[model samples]
Target: MDKKQFVDEVRSIAEGYFERGEFFCSEAVVKTINDVLDKPFDENVTKLASGFPVGIGKSGCVCGAISGGVMALGMVYGREHGQAMQEKMFPMSADLHDHIKGIYKSTCCRVMTRNFEFASPERKAHCIKITGEVAAYIAEKLYDEKVINK
Candidate 1:
């Protein structure tokens, strides 16, 4: 799909998942990431989030939504490329992270949702919205970068 379509799809998935309360599961997040893009969740994205639920200790350290954003970046920039190409794309990770942080204020669930415990229903709702917004933003950035760089 094109960039606009891709972003729209991500937004749609985010809203759907948020409504269903399935934003915490990595696979569910990955499905959201994939539905808008050309491919399914790549190994790199999942690998990073392996035990990181959100980050560090599943205490929602880095905010799963932001992790999902990072994963989306990895899929596009981490694809096999020559050393030179890889070098340029590597910097995109930081950019993507910054973008995510800017949107949600912090990549951590604690900060984004003000839920250090992460057990409350309010925190859950906040987390879902944060992830959805992050997903939409990242998808848009990916589409823009891919198109411009191509």
Candidate 2:
């Protein structure tokens, strides 16, 4: 899909706000990116996120956005060569981390809330939408940068 098309698809998914429970925005991003790349949804990424939003237990250890980004990165370039692979992945992982961090710095509940339990219903909805947007933006950027292909 093209950039506008991808953004529109994400916007549609995020339009409906949710007050509680895990949002499927992360899954949506994975699905969209996979679609764009003509790749299947990586089972590992999906599994990693199965308990998210809820698994956070309202603590927000790693923001869902970053967590989801890590999942996608793992799927694209997971370790197989042990230590060497781990070392090689540092820069790549850092790139993904920085991308998410930039977005969070601008508008974030994960930073402000400290504890997810403190998030108001409005904050939850905002975070839900933001997570979706970040996922889409990163996925599209990777595709455009030729880091992945359709």
Candidate 3:
């Protein structure tokens, strides 16, 4: 599919996954990235992201959406043998981090969700939208950098 189409699809799928309880924010983000990208990763990648929710075991540090976006970028651009690839990968991940943080003054999950409870309706809707946004942004960045074909 085209980049636009892919981004849209990722957004929808990520949101659906979260809203349907198929996955949490972090899991949904990684799952959407895996689905949008042509290459399939080990199923455990999503599991690795499991603890990232609520800001790493709910400690509420960096946003899980940002973490998941970075993971998605790494899956696409990370090198198995060297750090050289990080020059490119890190910037992309940082860009995503910046974008997400710009939405709120802080990237801390606690700060971002301070207005709502974890299981509250508002928090649920907010998390689902952001999870989807991060997933879609990761896909768009990959396309913009020509890491993937349109």
Highest lDDT, which number?
A: 3
Candidate 1 local lDDT, 1-150, one digit each (tens): 666676766776776765685545343455566655655555344445445455545674776665666666655566564544556455666775677678667766666666445677666666666666767776677667563221
Which digits, one per residue and each the tens of the lDDT, describe model 2 over residues 23-112?
Answer: 453554454455445565544545556444522544545555555555666656666565346453566667766666675663233573
List, residue by residue over 80-139, the lDDT tens digit for candidate 3. Answer: 875566577878877888888888777889998999987899998988888988988887
- lDDT (Cα, 0-100) at 58 in candidate 1: 62
In model 3, the worst 10-residue window by lDDT is 81-90
| Candidate 1 runs further than 4 Å off | 1-6, 23-28, 40-50, 79-85, 115-117, 146-150
Q: Give the TM-score of candidate 1.
A: 0.69
Q: Candidate 3 — what's its lDDT?
A: 0.84
lDDT by candidate, in order shown: 0.60, 0.54, 0.84
Quote the lDDT for 57 in model 2. 40
TM per candidate? 0.69, 0.63, 0.91
Residue 76, candidate 3: alpha-carbon lDDT: 76
The residue pairs in collision within model 3 are: none
Stronger candidate by TM-score (1 vs 3): 3
User: Between candidates 2 and 3, which one is better according to lDDT?
Assistant: 3
Q: Is candidate 1 or candidate 2 better by TM-score?
A: 1
